[model samples]
Target: MSLTLSKKASEVKPSSTLAITAKANELKAKGIDVVGFGAGEPDFNTPDNINQAAIKAINEGFTKYTPASGIEELKKAVCKKFKEFNHIEYNTNQVVISNGGKHSLTNIFTAILNPLDEVIIPAPYWLSYPEIVRLSNGVPVFIKGGKEQGYKVSAKQIEEACTDKTKALVLNTPNNPTGMVYLREELEAIAEVVIRKDIYVVADEMYENLIYGDKEHVSIASLNDEIYKRTITCSGVAKSYAMTGWRIGYTGSSVEIAKLMGSVQSHQTSNPNSIAQKATVEALLGNQDTIATMKEEFNKRREYMYDRVCNMPLLHTLEPEGAFYQFIDVSEVLEKEYKGSKIQTTEKLGAILIEDFNVAVIPCADFGFENHIRLSYAISIEKIKKGLDRIEDFLNQLK
Candidate 1:
């Protein structure tokens, strides 16, 4: 018999962020002194309280198959979180806990999208959005948000992108890669568009707790009853509580959508990890000071990285308002020659940096921008300084 594979699975692209991080790790394993800037998780360990919660659960033999949706306690905690943090009121029945934020998104798209339905995703988006949409048999429609706009799409742009087949719009605040947060007015306008178009809004607030400066995270679903009815709000303890490995994410939506996602999750991966669920409960309701500390440290790193990149010749980046990434525009650098050959692309520049400069950076082609690269500050300040110095050295050598 000829070898065969699922066409849908074959068509999906691997996550560039993970691939770059893996390569950086591989080099480190080989004893190379690589200063990596590709990490997406916090450098800090999970809080001791959260860890203790997991240990306590294990000691109590809390490991077992939970309800396909999640534990009632976790669901109630998520509902409380939504009420207090996001200003959105959702009951336990409206929530579904999954393996991770990505899994929550997968369940969402699976529950809501019919074949060929369109999901309007802004450009320079989290690289996984388009792939996940495609995997769920939904088409991804992109609208670009240029550098001048702080990498955020306007309500007008979103309104223009919609069609009769539009099923949803992805709104990621404290966005990955760009670190830009949408303003309240901006979200209000977008919410109006979402309602007028009568489409679902997938509010991905994974980095909600990581916003820097005076900017605050505002969930579009909280704006009004109409948009709330049409929105599915997703969040997790990964970024906020430094629990990426815990694999716990939850969402709030209508009871109908929640049931569908739960039913789909039942066969896919019954409940999130039992211990992780217990830990997540503590993460949501515990001390909460750790998040503020992590945010402060991340702000310091963000300022340092932004200043360094701004001073580097032929490199440009907007001051990131939130999250822990600096989305650098490397177009000028790519146009220049390094080692007597034109760099030409973000991938080539990244490869040269890793091979010669002993630095790892994520090239952003898969993120819908060919001339940009994302540098994450989710590492120690010392490592960040080293990586920036190498990047500056590389740029200085570009003729």
Candidate 2:
């Protein structure tokens, strides 16, 4: 009598950040001056040269389909990129280009994960890791890290979590929520366990060029030869070059993994947009001075926000050595009353801040950390300072 939708479509939860964005928009449309710190994107625009390249491609009728894996030129650019940045060797055949960093990860997860295979993810990770693993029919296992250890899981925890069913592990340096970049020494320890356990590692370096303070972003695959053989290096121009709308990301792995991903790409979405490919080639080979300028701006904002938030009495904020986020532990302010509403969860904290103070930040519960909330410093310094001033006032009242 009626058609039904697949269970896969129904099982997916609405994306966490998107929900926050919608609510923020609803408030903003009603003339509220809300400072949004929820989105994980740079506030910069795509570089002019890259944008021109896309225009040139479109004018020249470069609007057709590409190989499912990617165009040869784009793959070659990716090959040159790995050699230059990470000191890893890759041929064109070893790379596959997809829609965005998210799509690239989903492709990698789908290509490799068999049903019931376990994927080991570090806690306080990207919101999509566990979701993608589950969507691919893989079991997601998490190992938690705390502020005491600079928000990093140890080799012991990783080794303890592994079993015969373990298939893949995700390693995100200068990680999304915490912005904790793994030191080379720390990565070497994890890599040792990984190489011994014969588990595949997905090295997510989406924020590779955005380090600040004294921290350095290390590519885990570059540490050792054995780990390189089993690593899928994923990244995009989105975070680094402010090309989020370009929807181009690439991955480098063994030829076998690349080809299998190609198969997945063919059946699901075929090739990515040809214009994005041409634009990405320009981005990869063009002068990188723009990236340096953006990094400098982000660093200034990061330090300013870090110093201010870390000094708040009721909040415990760790200074992230890299990335533009400050993950603030907010357990001290969790009481039964915030504007007369019971404030128990970080979601409630965020909601109260939105309703009363007109600020938008992500509650940390969705990132597998219950006692925290993430504030992004990607906005202008004036807005950041003003928002913090408002938040500080609200927290003082709670105390």
Candidate 3:
């Protein structure tokens, strides 16, 4: 007998970055020197102090189940985090912890969405936003933002995407794939629309501490008390503290919304990892000097990689103000053929890069942009240079 998947399950697409990562691993297994730029994660290991906290938790026999919404200790830490960095206020009852930033977002959407609800997603967004919305039986409205506007989808575009059916909008500042960090004014403008429409705002501040330059990220929750009341502000220790594998993320918002997410998380995943929760306390409360150092390193590498890619043949790059990726435009190379393959799209460019140059980058089609590739600068300066050199050599010979 044949089995069928549920319509909800069938609606989701595989993660595009993971596809490139899988091929990179395949080539690596075959003894190829594949340099994967497809990773959306930081290359740095979790800080030693955070690791020790986890060890301490385990040794102290603190391995039992935590509350569905997270332990009071960790929830308190999350509350402290918003107070420290964002200057917003929250209580333990208003926060829920999940496996990661994505998991937190999933909980938020699953708890609120009814079938066919509309979700507005600015394009060149994280790969999972549209899929998550669709999986929740909601319709995704895409607002395309290319290199023309700092890759930022404007408030006018967002206003057009809204309708009575619009239930929520996903905002990923220091965004994945494109690294477009929305400024305070930009977020306030969007917040105005959301407040007037009385729609929920899902704020994904996963890359909260990765901002470079003179830029500052202001939470939409801070725009006004009403926005704060309606916004589900999600953040994780993953990007900011380099604790990606720890699998602990959290959100702060209205008590009602938090209660709903807690209910969803209770049955779905139960509590988050217990040891990770203890470790996350240290990560959130510990000295953030390491974050500054990491950002400095990132800034240096970002500038270096930007210059190197700009000098590369057939590559057009935009300077991303935050996050570690350089979304290079490769539309000029379309229609060019190599090794019996006509490079007609970003997908072709990706497949060829993995197969030939052993360099893996996520194609823009995943992020709803068809003419670009996302390259992460989270690796070492030397590695970034090496990968760019290899990419340049391959593209130069693409004729």
TM per candidate: 0.98, 0.98, 0.97
After superposing candidate 2, which stretches have Cα over 4 Å from the reference? 1-3, 340-342
Q: Sorted by lDDT, highest first, which candidate order results?
A: 1, 2, 3
Q: What is candidate 2's CA lDDT for residue 287?
A: 82
The 10-residue segment of model 1 with minimum total lDDT is 14-23
- The alpha-carbon deviation from the true structure for residue 292 of candidate 3, after best TM-score superposition, in angstroms, is 2.1
> Which candidate number has the best lDDT?
1
lDDT of 1 at 146: 93
- lDDT string for model 3 (1-399, tens) is 698879778667887778888889988998888888877778888888899999999999999998988999999999988988887899999999999988998888888899999999988888888888888788999998878888888888888888989999888888888877898889989888888888999999988889888888888897789899889999998888888888999999889989999998999889999999999999989877887888899899899988888887778877778888898888888757777667898888888888878888888888888888899998888878878888888877776
Model 1 score (lDDT): 0.92
lDDT per residue for candidate 2 within 210-239, as digits (tens), equals 888777778888887899998999999899
Clashing pairs in 3: none
lDDT of 3: 0.87
Q: Is candidate 1 or candidate 2 better by TM-score?
A: 1
Query: What are the lDDT scores of the predictions, listed in order?
Result: 0.92, 0.89, 0.87
Mark the 10 consecutive residues where model 2 has the least summed lDDT. Answer: 333-342
What's the ranking of the predictions by TM-score, best on top?
A: 1, 2, 3
10 residues in a row with least lDDT, candidate 3? 333-342
Error of 3 at 181 (Å): 1.2
Error of 2 at 281 (Å): 0.9
**Candidate number of the best TM-score:** 1
